[model samples]
Target: MKSLCRIGHSLHSRGLTFGSSGNISVRLPEGGWIVTPTNVAMGDLDPSQLSLLDDDGKWIDGPKPTKETFLHAAMYGARRDAGAVVHLHSTHSVAVSVLEDIDPADVLPAITAYYVMKVGALRLIPYFPPGDPALGEAVAGFADKHHALLLANHGPVVAGADLRSAQYAAEELEETAKLFLLLQGHKIRPLTASQAAALKQ
Candidate 1:
């Protein structure tokens, strides 16, 4: 959580997120995980304010786990390759959530080879209330197929090889979301399935 606290503060300071609108977690080197607490100001989150939880969502120690513990737990469960989770209420990415027709199967276009190789397919999960278990379940359901997902009318959650990778992926998600919005009114000549597949390889 100390790590997330620092990252959250940095993100907030840089205007990537604000208030208590985002949460981050990292699997500890030894075991367990450290996560940000719910509704706490990112700028004020000290190590003391963070939560440590076991893989099963059990509080192993430290402050109470974030209300979104289940969501992080589900990520850890579904993606054994994941060592960290980052959920952010970034401005542009959340903006992508309100569109009525965002495709869940392959929401993000391979507008660039970098997006294709780094993020693969970005999915859009349906709207679930804040702290809802169904949100976790939905993410878990698509874990194997995506590295990043846009939560409807909410934000984005990304799971990656490590905390650094998760953070990078979250930033990439926001950047792509902004691109997606900018190109909204235009005809997009995005990469086709075959181009995406070839680039991914």
Candidate 2:
């Protein structure tokens, strides 16, 4: 819980999230997860008020889980290795999502080795209203093969082996998105498929 609070504070302070616009969750060792509560500012998450869900995703205690709980559950259900998930309405990421002609299979190019390593391939989930079950299903459809996804006109969803990993990957994604936009209209050289594959291995 303290860890979640710390990361939440860091994300909020850094402007990664604003006005209760992001969500995070970490799987519990015993079972289920500790999730940020609904409609609460990430800057002010109380440890005791964090939502707790049992293994089946039933709310066991604390405040209500983020309405996007289905998003987290979908990731966990698809990827057994995903220990944490982070979803954010970050500026750059959301900007990229709305851009036309971006590939849905893998949105961003491998701009940096760190980007390739931390957030390998990013799939684009089609637009769906917030809290829509179809959105969750769309995420699940790609979660097994992808640790990261960008929702159309929404933002990014990233899963990692642990909370910090998820957080760092999410930050890396935002930074890469910023770089992608900055380098537009330039003759840029993103890593080739072979190079990116090597980093993944």
Candidate 3:
């Protein structure tokens, strides 16, 4: 719980998310999860206030889970290796998501080696109203194959083997999205498929 609070505060302090604009969750080893509560400011999270849920998404303790609980659960359902999930309405990533020309299949380009290494392939899911069940279903469709995803007109969701990893990848996705937008209309040099593949090796 301390770790989750710390990460939440860090993300909020760094301007990655503010107010109640994001949600985070970490899977428990004993078959459940600890998730941020709905409508709580990330900067003001209390460890004890975090929601606890059973494997089946039953509320066991703490405050009510974020309205987007289904999205986190969907990722866990699809990826056995996922230990933590980070969803943020970050500025740059949301900006990139709303761009019409960007390919939905691969929202961001392999603009940097670190982006390639940390974020890998970023799938873009179409827009769905906040807390919409359809959003969870869309995320589940590709959660197992991709660690990072961009929600159309929304933001980014990233899953990792642990909290720190997920946070780092989320940050990377935001930064890369910023770079992608900054370089728009410029003759930018993106890494080739071979180069990106080599980085994954």
Task: Estimate every model's Cα lDDT from 0 to 1.
Answer: 0.83, 0.93, 0.92
Q: State in Å the error of residue 136, model 2.
A: 0.5
Estimate candidate 1's alpha-carbon lDDT, on a 0 to 1 scale.
0.83
In order of appearance, the predictions have TM-scores of 0.92, 0.98, 0.98
Over 4 Å off, model 1: none
Cα lDDT tens digits for candidate 3, 49-110: 99999886778999989999988988899989999999999999999999889888888899
Judged by lDDT relative to the true structure, which candidate is superior, 2 or 3? 2
Task: List the candidate 2 regions with Cα displacement exceeding 4 Å.
Answer: none
On a 0 to 100 scale, what is the lDDT of residue 72 in model 2? Answer: 92
Q: lDDT ranking from best to worst?
A: 2, 3, 1
Could you tell me how far off, in angstroms, the CA of residue 175 lies in candidate 2 after the best superposition?
0.4
Q: Model 2: how far is 123 from its true place, Å?
A: 0.2
Per-residue lDDT tens digits for candidate 2, residues 1-201, read 899889999999999999998999999888899899999999998888899988667788998889999899999999999999999999999999999989999899999999999999899999999989899999999999999999998899999999999999999999999999999999999999999999988
